[model samples]
Target: MASLLLPIAAAFLLLRVILSATVIDDLRNLRPPPDFNSTIARNCHHNPSLRYCGNSRPLDEIFKFTIVASHLCNESRNPNCVESFDKIDLRGRPKIAPLYLSFDFFWKFCPLTIRSIDFSNNSLRGEFPTSVLACAQAEAIDFSHNELSGDFPVERLASMVNLTVLNLSYNHFSECKLSESLVFRRFNSSNFVHSGLIPNKQSFAVKAVFLMIGLPVMVILTVGFIAMMCFRRRNLSLETPQLRHHFTTSMLKAATSGFSSENLEEKSDGVDIYRGILRDGTHVRIEIYWSNISTEGMRKFIEECEVLVQLRHKNLVRVFGWCDDQELRAIVTKWTDRESLEMWLIERAPPLKHRLKVLAGVMEGMCYLHKSWPQVGYDLGTSSIILSENLEPLISRFEFDGRNSSAKSKFVYKHKFGVLLLEMITDRGKMGDVEAGKAGFIEHIRTSFTANWQNLLDERIMIASTTMEQARQAIEIGLACIDHSANEQLNMDWIRHILLRIYRASCHVNGSPTHGRFDGDRDKRHKHGP
Candidate 1:
């Protein structure tokens, strides 16, 4: 009994030594309430030292506790280290106790209360801790930019139903390529390189579409608005008066779900768009204007909106209605389940056939817009173009017209106009020498830039002998549309003929007899020897 009592006393003393060990209380002072407002800081790693310290406001005191488990953390021979719960940084400041024993102690602890865990940009080693399996509430995890090895255990990740954002950027995840089905479920690819996870074809296309189309168009509409101010001096007299559409600030707030962050789209010219669904089961895209709108310009914008709403061409985006009451002005268009054409194109693989099809639809739409309306210069470039389910092109945002009906003047106009046409032809608007031009009026326009198209062709369009001629013809039409002299520019009537000829050439190359179904008149013309 004496021996047993002595052993028990020894164990009790060991426990006391651990429990009585001094902890740096100042560290605990950094704890914040669990409800820190999260603003998605993109590419947060850009400034690696810029630490995002969480709200230092303390959580309920009851949530605070310390356990003397440091001795158990002695997995290595490093004698200086203490056994304790693993410390995880919330934002930048360290919180959550150090891991006791192996990191597996995480399973025994934080699986319940912790909602977000960010272990990014650290020298964290080992495979992703399987202990996270117990984290039912773990919705967002940032394990990117770490020294983690091994394949991305996707099977384990997919099990986390609550996970909304999984950032796995800057890690050695190369062997673990993710499926299209996987990325489709995940939203943001915050730092997707080095993951070795090539997204499947469909996902690649979708992601490309989002980046290429969504980003470029957004940048153009945004930057073009500013760049276009330079042209204002030339067309000062041609400015149209905006129409009035007024709405109260209260109505605007209600429509936008109190201007929630989730609804927010791109911010341009002090305008914020919210993905708003109206009470009438109508999908209303809400755009809140911060800049001043002249009454005449507003009126003209409304008239254009109304005009577009009336048209039902296959390649045209249908506008439902506009609401301008109080301080809000919103336009309701038909809700497309598939996001945008730009988004679609950005994520898709390089295919000449698909590119041709997209151009053809856009050309058909432009033909209708210019010819059917007469005197209207359907300015369907850049931001105005969209894509459909079959990857067909659909034009949008045609409300803002240049207000100039006459032919363009000066070489600079020719260059800008040429770049615009090049985008339609090559599907790559990343302008370079082809757009900048060398010398003279012809050089400023695309008509003189045949060499540029050869360079700018998206590498995805495989160099197939079959599709070369059709692609060349398409390029020719784009050049024709942006002739140096405005009078030299082919009319839409003639442009449509060129487009049909290109389409016919594509059909011949592919030997696709089904092409006739798309154009009964073309089939008739062929039969009647056009």
Candidate 2:
């Protein structure tokens, strides 16, 4: 019986050994759950400076916490770094104490998975890190209440479409000249509160100071000076009758060949524009207003004449004189052989460089007018811009009557300029259909800008990488100009500067200077006539 029991025990022990071996084999074959701690541990080894809570905690939670806390906290400064991790909030966890981290160090070590960064109320000084522009996925950034200095990267920040919130107030930053793009317009004056933010305010303050000191003194001096000058002028006017150059009805009729079909260039709103040559062989265009003369109409015409006579710019058509006869009222101006922008665009497809030069010229003129005479408004449109013999753009037929017209609003000018830009790039004649309704125009541009703006570009023009970049920037500027929000519209100064930059870049791409000093033969090839 003892021998049988011993054999049974041996069999049982052998089975147990076989079962244990099989279990070990199965365990070896089956892979263990992935240990995230390995990756954390490797990163720690790679970066010796990186600190971790411990290897005891769950790997997933500790890894996420370490990534955030590593750059945010310095163990030397605050030994209780692990305790602060619990207070982390999605909105933003304000620092209880300042972090003495350089911009480069923070950005280099900060994980790309971070969605929000709040570095407010710190001493983060240095030039804005260009690396911040790479955080494409970052949504919110608060750099307010810091000692940041140098030129803020407003344009680059604006380009980040994913960025929704940005607070840059209370910083030691230099004046940031924000372009009137959708990104810059997203913030208000509140975003930028430092001195020199609004350039005009400084001049305005100086003017105010000068006015307070000099106004009374000048008023007294002017009262005495004007009285004497008025008496002398009254006597001179009575004696001389002020001989002025005026065109008579018969003279204009003769010049325009009695308003013949060949001479008639355009007739709109009871105004007939006739192309004519003067008796002295000078080419001219005669604008004859045929509407029945009303008191208001005559007053406005006189006011426009006064304003035009005072204005002199290379980009403005030279107004020779006006005809105010009882029967016919006309304005005589120098003729632009190259004709209106609308006609030139239809007849000749200019290269991007030439088109940008023309646009720059227009903006320069507009900027001048907007700055020198804020009260004066222009009737800006495609037909209103005329090209000179040298392909220079001139703003013509812009009459100011000392009244606010919708066309005079900076927003309106931006909209018109945007349409003109779109025309130049897309080869579209007019944006009448798009501008007919504001909603449709916005949606069209927004969609096209996002999906594929290249499709909208003119196929006639060859698109290189540099040229494509320029076109994309111009399209963005156009979109910003025509933004539905009035506040979003770029001021004439900003628009002019941006357009000039684009013009310079375009000229560089074409191997020319900012003024586009092309060869005589190339110039001749591009010249067109009405």
For this target, which candidate reaches the highest lDDT against the unseen true structure? Answer: 2
Q: Candidate 1 lDDT, tens digit per residue, 268-384? A: 777777776655566666656666678986787666655655667888776656665545566656556565545544666535555566665765676565445433344444555
lDDT of every model, 2 decimals: 0.52, 0.63
For model 1, what is the C-alpha lDDT against the true structure?
0.52
Query: What TM-score would each prediction reach against the true structure?
Result: 0.43, 0.47
Report the C-alpha displacement of residue 483, candidate 2, in angstroms: 1.6
Distance from true position, residue 419, model 2, in Å?
Answer: 2.1
**TM-score for candidate 2:** 0.47
Clash count (model 2, backbone only): 0
- Regions of model 2 farther than 4 Å from truth: 1-245, 257-262, 267-269, 401-408, 427-439, 463-466, 484-489, 517-530
Worst 10 residues of 2 by lDDT: 521-530
